[model samples]
Target: MIKKFLVFSALLCSAVFCNAQNAQLEAAVGKLTRLMVTPDSLGLDSILLDNLSYGHSNGGLQSKPQFMRSLLTGASDFVEIDLTDKQVVIQNKIALVRHTLSAKTNDKNIPGKVKLYILLVWSNEKTGWKLLARQAVKVPEK
Candidate 1:
């Protein structure tokens, strides 16, 4: 009876650990989306690497500082960010998140919607999970 109880406890612990990891990934993505919507460049400065690479849906690469500057200068105003069909996978301290991103822009008198499939890599930091990299591709029209 003692052995059975021990086994059950181990299983329960494993389940809770898995759920906690899932919550961490979800929170990371949520914070990132919030930063984008608010155009909070300074807030992102601490969450992304100094030399982070951004894979734009328009087939361009944006460096970390460049990306931040754009948002701060109002060059890119994210009107809305919607995440859908999100899947989070974690291995050790690394996590991969895939989701459909629907965003609207209020840029230079141009207003339009852009839909893309995004893959984000996150790393667990001493502070929390920080976005390590991001790659986005324009969603193909059906």
Candidate 2:
């Protein structure tokens, strides 16, 4: 009976820990979307790892420096960003985040709308949760 109780208690504690972690991760994802729309170099730099791999739906890829440069220079301009259908999974110190990105953009002064499926990888580092990688693919239309 004592053994069973201990096992149950451990499981309960784990569940609560997982829920807390999920909430923190969700907030981090939201922060990322906001920074994407309104480029904040410091805020972004803090959340991204030095070797970030950012991939666009067009098969374009950017390293951390390249990504930061584009956002800072308004080259990869984002007028508005909306994310929906978000899901997050955590394993050890790594997290996999999936969501639908619906955004209105003015890239190179040309207005455009994009709906894409996005996958983001985050690692829980010494500072906090930092984005390690991201990939985007176009969402199919009906």
Candidate 3:
């Protein structure tokens, strides 16, 4: 009976540990999506590194300061953003997140609805998964 109780307790601990990791991932993704899709940029510093590399589907690149400034100024506006088909792979202190992003936005130089495959490399900092690099590829239509 003692052995059985120990086994059950171990299993419960394992389940809890796994669930906590999953929850962390979900929260990280949620924060990132909110930052990307909204005009407010207050919470972005917590989720992204100071030196973030943002690669766009249109073959453009933006640094962290540049991106934040663009969003702050009225240079970019998001109409809709849908993040789907997320796959997160965690290894040690790093994680790779791949997802399908469908978004409608109007920026100062660009305006349109776009669908893309986005891959973001995240590092498990002391806080959580902080985005370090991102690449967006245009989704090919069938």
The predictions' CA RMSDs to the true structure, in order, are: 1.5, 1.3, 2.3
Ranking by lDDT: 2, 1, 3
Q: lDDT per residue, candidate 1, 1-142, as tens digits?
A: 9999999999999999989888977887898898887867667987886667888878888888888887777787789999999988899888999999999988765898899999998888887788878999989999
Which structure among the candidates has the greatest TM-score? Answer: 2
Kindly provide the TM-score of model 2 when superposed on the true structure, using C-alpha atoms. 0.93
User: 1-142 in candidate 3: lDDT tens per residue?
Assistant: 9999999999999889767877897788888887777756668777888889999888889998887777777586676799999998877777889999988888675788888999988887898878899999999999
TM-score versus the correct structure, for each prediction: 0.90, 0.93, 0.83
What global local distance difference test value does model 3 have? 0.84
C-alpha local distance difference test of each model: 0.86, 0.91, 0.84
Backbone clash count, each prediction separately:
0, 0, 0
Candidate 2's C-alpha lDDT?
Answer: 0.91
Model 2 clash pairs are: none
Tens digits of per-residue lDDT for model 2, 1-142: 9999999999999999988888888888878888888888898898899999999999999999899889878888889988899888899999999999998988888899999999999998877789999999999999
Local error of candidate 3 at residue 58 (angstroms): 2.4
